[model samples]
Target: MKRFPIGILEFLTWTIALTGLFFFARVEGPHAGLCPIANLGLTWCPGCGLGRSIHLFLRGDFLASWEMHPMGSFAVLVIVWRQFELLYLIKKQLKSWQTY
Candidate 1:
């Protein structure tokens, strides 16, 4: 197997970390200081409201999630799929290296 890129691992780490933070916020209620765009004094962001939407979707409130952000559920699904793909690649690489 070819060497796995360090950057890919870094990216995957951040993605997983952010997803964990989202779940934490969902359980702990809204963390007002968490949104970088809002903290930067921006009135709007392309991903504004997505966190709330995802939380709702995770809690089985799909309709409310869609009302908050039309594509929130789909975005979460894609993120999950990407994470799985990354993990699969990492596992395959390790297995091949062990055999060699």
Candidate 2:
């Protein structure tokens, strides 16, 4: 089997994450009602409100974002870092393959 520089599954996962972020940032208010846990009679889960928080953070509402979820900004930073790392890994893999 032959493998390309970037795998389809990995590319799709990042694309989905970015797409979700784009929509979340544009939508108003907390959309947590769509969460399965919310429907399961749980008022709040550990990850509850994180999506809105991230959206707020992306919209420059840092204080409001932190108020919604303290780790929201951190999570965003981590996601960005992960993307960079993925690119780096792909580059390294391609370089190694070229030496074969």
Candidate 3:
């Protein structure tokens, strides 16, 4: 029962994290906020190019997006998969509840 709300929250949390990752990456060097990951380590992290990639994506520049991250395509696929899985779980939950 309570699992339903937990699942919904999990979906929201990840989506927010993804959106924030995109925005944070888009900024120029030396953003005024906190990002311990970029600060504590090298300039290039796994998410280093994500901002540029996201900007390009929003503008419908597919090539530029891919240029920013070679595995940018995988990122999109993973996001879609996560969303679909969440929806599937919700649907299954609702169906089970109705049968009870």
Candidate 4:
């Protein structure tokens, strides 16, 4: 059996993750997050609220999304751009293989 290329795996991972985020509802109430730091009784976590932020941004609540996290919209754009970049790289790699 042939192994899958890392680029393909990465693209799929990003696609699935974003798709899930796009469909899932925004988390409500306190302590609803899965942050390990918050679970550990720490109140501050740099990465906390990022997922909720993305969810809000996807749902068309830009203000709420920004309130949740400043980089939410930017994160979405970067992820999408990376997906396209991965596709381009994967296509180029396949073309290279076809020449052999």
Candidate 5:
């Protein structure tokens, strides 16, 4: 088995995190209607709709995800952008990884 570079590992880490988040977002069963923020007297929190947004995004429902939570989508975009940017840099620095 071949070992990947740090950049590759970083990308994989982020991808795995997203996969977890996606699964988390898709949980819409028994406790779906519960919102602690309502009782806490807070209008919003970063994770307020993250789960639903992520779930909708994984299902390819972009508009629904946006409606659910705009910040999560933005977070996803930033994650992907950084991963791709890191890959580009790796390719440029490592001649052996040029074809990657």
Candidate 6:
């Protein structure tokens, strides 16, 4: 099978992640995410509520998003910025190729 380029792979991964977060259902009580610390049976993890926080942020619940994780909004901004960066890189690469 042909392999996907790194840029394409990254773009797809981020797209899927954001899309999933957008559709992620709100959960009450404990967060059931794939956090290694939580999986290790620890009571607290710094990154635990990030996904839920992003989900809440996407759904326009800023206060709850902040409550879920202080960096959630910032994380969203970074992720979106990364997406744009990837697109710019891809566009730059295409333009360079056209010059050859």
Which candidate's lDDT is highest? Answer: 4
Clashing residue pairs for model 2: none
Candidate 6: where is the Cα deviation over 4 Å?
Answer: 1-6, 29-31
Candidate 6 residue-wise lDDT, 16-42, digit = tens: 998998896564775457778889989
What does each candidate score in C-alpha RMSD?
Answer: 4.1, 2.7, 3.4, 2.4, 5.0, 3.1
Report the CA-based lDDT of candidate 3 relative to the real structure.
0.68
User: What are the runs in model 5 whose C-alpha is more than 4 Å off?
Assistant: 1-4, 30-43, 96-100
Candidates 4 and 5, the one with greater TM-score: 4
Clash pairs, model 1 backbone? none
* lDDT digits (tens) for residues 10-94 of candidate 2: 7568768766875655445444466788789888887877877888887788998899889989988887777788888887877
Better of 3 and 5 by lDDT: 5
* TM-scores of all candidate predictions against the true structure: 0.64, 0.73, 0.65, 0.81, 0.63, 0.82
RMSD of 1: 4.1
Q: Which structure is stronger by lDDT: 4 or 6?
A: 4
Clashes of 2: 0
Distance (Å) between predicted and true CA of 65, model 4? 0.6
Cα deviation of 73 in candidate 5 (Å)? 1.9
Candidate 6 colliding pairs:
none
The order of the candidates by lDDT, greatest first, is: 4, 6, 2, 5, 1, 3
| Number of the candidate with higher TM-score, 1 or 4 | 4
Per-residue CA lDDT of candidate 4, range 1-100, in tens? Answer: 3335559989999999988998974668754767788889997888988998999998899999999989989999999999999999988887777777
Q: Each model's C-alpha lDDT? A: 0.72, 0.76, 0.68, 0.86, 0.75, 0.84
| Lowest lDDT block of 10, candidate 3 | 24-33
lDDT tens digits, residue span 1-100, model 5: 3346658788789888888877755545644546777558687766777767876877788998898888767877888899999888677657665556
Q: Give the alpha carbon lDDT tens digit for every residue of 1-100 in model 3.
A: 3345336777787688667765655534654535567778657677766656765665567898888876766676677689879878877787778876
Q: Count the backbone clashes (under 3 Å) in each candidate.
A: 0, 0, 0, 0, 1, 0
Predicted candidate 1 versus true structure: per-residue lDDT over 1-100, tens digit per residue: 4686434775567587556646664524455666788889998877777877887777788998898788889977887787777777777767778887
Query: Candidate 4 or 5, higher lDDT?
Result: 4
